[model samples]
Target: MNPNDRSIVALVMTGHGLVHTYELSIPIFMTAWLGELGVSEAALGAVVGAGYFLFGAGALPGGVLVDRFGSRRLIAGCFVGMGGAFVLLGLLPGLWGLGAALLAWGAAASVYHPAGLALISTGVQQRGRALAYHGIAGNVGIAGGPLATALLLLAFDWPTVAVLLGLPALLAAVGAWRTSFDERAAVGVHDAPDAGHGEPSPRPDDRAALWTRSKALFASGFAGVFVLVALSGLYYRGMLTFLPDLLTPLVTVDLPIDVAAGRYVYAGLLAVGIAGQYVGGRLSDHARTEWALAGALAVLAAVAVVFLPVAGVGTAALLAVSAVLGFFLFLVQPLYQATVAEYTPPEARGLSYGYTYLAIFGVGAAGAAGAGGLLQIAGPPLLFGALAGLALLGASLSGGLAVRRARVGTHP
Candidate 1:
């Protein structure tokens, strides 16, 4: 790819990083936020759920807009909108205010996937690597969100933390507006114009469009892949959402170890996710995506096993297991995302990406809520066990895709 292409990907990916860093703070600092608002766990889940619902709802429309115009404009708009939402979130007074701000942020966040993925498909020769970079950048942003909030909460309040987080999004938004992506190269190679609206109206075959997508998905082994991706999203988000609570027990150990030790220990586990992101990216290039996903899930399985069996394990073992789980858990994200790209048609790639995110965040948000309920009912063993079972299901789903691909004699 040309320098311009690299520049575009870097900018878009960085914008995504900023958005996640700012917008995802609530979940990262949920304990503090809930304390400040005096809300129940279930209520917190509902608020977060509303954010995710809007996030998914906006995607399909975002896809249509990206396809109609181009990824560049949509990305620029998304960044600015997200930045505004963060600022609003910071300024919000209570639960109602927070919910409104998150809804706005989620709507803005929706634009990124379709626009960014469309840009990747348009600009890069090695689409998988490009997506991996983007995914890793977002992971870095995710890790940063919590770390930043944790540090800020030590000195300032959640409101102050929210305001500070908005700064990155504001700056990134400005940078996005100034940058120009290679639109011609970025998309339009294979994307079909919407016959419903675009000029020189083509044959309107909504039924054919549906069938075409279905056939492509089946031919590409995406039907089974979707189950794995969906299950992976469920387990991944569920684990991450409650990670702090899970670490609470570990941190509260009555040992005379340092007070700061627990905080650092927990942060260290999350920081290790960076390695997982890199490993997953590289592994996807060499191994078939299914195998790569399976490998990651296998690691998650082992982590769950070690974590569940070892009672009162020391900080070292906790850190080790947490890091290992973080590694494998996050590693699967990019690979699964790349599979979505590989499976989609060029014309509807934006829509395909939108649908993928819809499935991920939409379904995953529900999973997060369900996880809290599961924890309430059965406790951590059942919670982690259920997570493990989901990962295993994802592995089996991927295996089915492999079998289907063998029968079809090729992978799309």
Candidate 2:
């Protein structure tokens, strides 16, 4: 990669990692929240879901902001918002306080996926490999965030950890300010009439024009892509939210004797996701992204169906299920990301990704509450079954998208 491409990816990758670091870290802290806050799983789940819901729900406007302003500026703003939110989390440290901080975080983090992914889709030359590397960075944060939180809990309290975690976001904001790169270096201004000079063409002023843009985008098979991502998100959030708690009982082998075993297993699952993202991103470059997405979703469905059964056999069995769960879980991300790039117009890419996350994180936020309630009442088998059902639905949708792409030809 040239210096500019490297710089752009580095900025985005770091920012992406930090976003998820804070994201995944919340679940780890939730473990403490259970006892500290004196809330039932169902109640805490709703609270967590509310925060995540806002995080996703805000992406629509955030995408508009990205198009109106620039990704760099919005990304900087995201860092500030997230950092400040975490600091607030440190101060409040109550159930209501947690919800408020997460709401702030959701609003802040909602800016990232659209801004960062739009930058990559527009800026990078080697889009596929760049996405692969970018996804790896995210996996690092996803895996490391909880691990870091778990490790810190061994020493400091959750409140202090929340404050310490905020530091990285502030640092990333500094990096964003210092970093320099051409945002539209790869795709160029000519390819995007409204999208050159590091700014999008002015957004449509009237509802009719806005509707026209949305209609055109969905007509291009992005509708399928959107639904696919939502399904994937449902499974993603449902599986991840309570995974540490769920695995706590299954852990038999001895560890550091200080930390909760489930937290490490959770981190390890995310660690394996690094490879999953690499392989998925690489595959997207070589084959139709939708096709690869279908296959991955299929594997996920199988794993979800078998997860509880496989996990119950022994510690080894549990670890085995966890590893597969981790790998294919993240593999879906880049595939859907690449598909969004292929299926949407470059000028409205921000809006496109906005809807994507709206589906994934917003609608998918329901999974947190759903998983929690189900786990409390119906237990793991039912929870895993519900997850498997969602994955199967996603796989079917992806398969349809793959077939649609085969018949219709690639999007412009």
Candidate 3:
């Protein structure tokens, strides 16, 4: 890549890492919040679910903003807003206050995927490689965030930990603000004649244009991909929300030193996803993304089915299974992201990612509620079974997509 591309990728990757660091770190605090705030599991789930809902539901608007305002501005704003929200979270005194902070955080976070992915899809030369690196950065954040939060909890209170966690984002915000890059130059779309002329282009009204795009996308089988993404999100969010809590009792590690076994195990599980993301991203560039997605979903289904049984075996077995599960879980992300790019036009990539994330994080927010409910009533077996079912559903949809693509002789 050129120096300019490298700079943009680095900046975006840094932002991506911080976004997820804040996101995944929240789960580590759930147990602490239960005791400190004196809330039921269901209520806590509802609160987190609300933030997650906005994280997704807000993406459409966020995408529009990205398309209008430019990706760099939105990404920089996300850093500031997310950091400020975390600072507020540290100072908040009640459940309602925490909820408000999370709401702010979610709103800020909602802008990231659309902006970042749009920047990458438009700016980067080797889209798949850039996406793989991007996924690796995010997985690093996922792996480190909870682990760091857990380790911090051992020394400082959750509030102080939240404050500390907000620091990196603030710094990233500064970095992003100072970094210079031309989105039009990187994407090369603005170089066309009349690109920046003060004359209006021969396009429909904004709403009409969006509607037309949406209809076209739906008619062209993007709807099926959207369904596959939503199901994947359901499985991803549902299984991950309470993975530490679920695995705590089942894992029996005999470490010599004092440590939060469950938290570390969770970290280890997510860390393995770095490899998964790399593999998935590379494979998406070479093979059919739908087929790759189907394979990953199949692995996820098998992992979900065997998760509980493996947990019963021993700590080693449980950790191994968790690692595998985490790998397949995150492996789907880059594949689906690449698939979305394949299915959309460069000019509308922001909007496409906006809808994609809405499915992934918005509808996917229900997974947390579903997991909490299942845990409350049916237990781990049913929860894992439900996850397995979701994965199977995704795999079936992906298989169907593959068939459809074959018949149409189109990559999307």
TM-score of each: 0.81, 0.87, 0.88
Q: Please report how far candidate 3 places residue 378 from its true position, in Å.
A: 2.5
Largest TM-score belongs to which candidate? 3
Q: Which stretches of candidate 3 lie over 4 Å from their true place?
A: 1-7, 119-133, 179-183, 187-205, 255-259, 341-350
Clashes per model (N, Cα, C within 3 A): 3, 2, 0
- Candidate lDDT (C-alpha), each: 0.67, 0.82, 0.80
In the range 191-292, model 1's lDDT, one tens digit per residue, is 543211111112124557755665665565455656666787788667766566567667535755422333344466667777876776677678777767
Q: Sorted by TM-score, highest first, which candidate order results?
A: 3, 2, 1
As for lDDT, the candidate ahead, 2 or 3, is 2
Give every collision pair in model 1.
122-186, 191-347, 192-347
Q: Rank the candidates by lDDT, best first.
A: 2, 3, 1
User: Cα miss at 114, model 2 (Å)?
Assistant: 3.0
lDDT of 3 at 356: 79
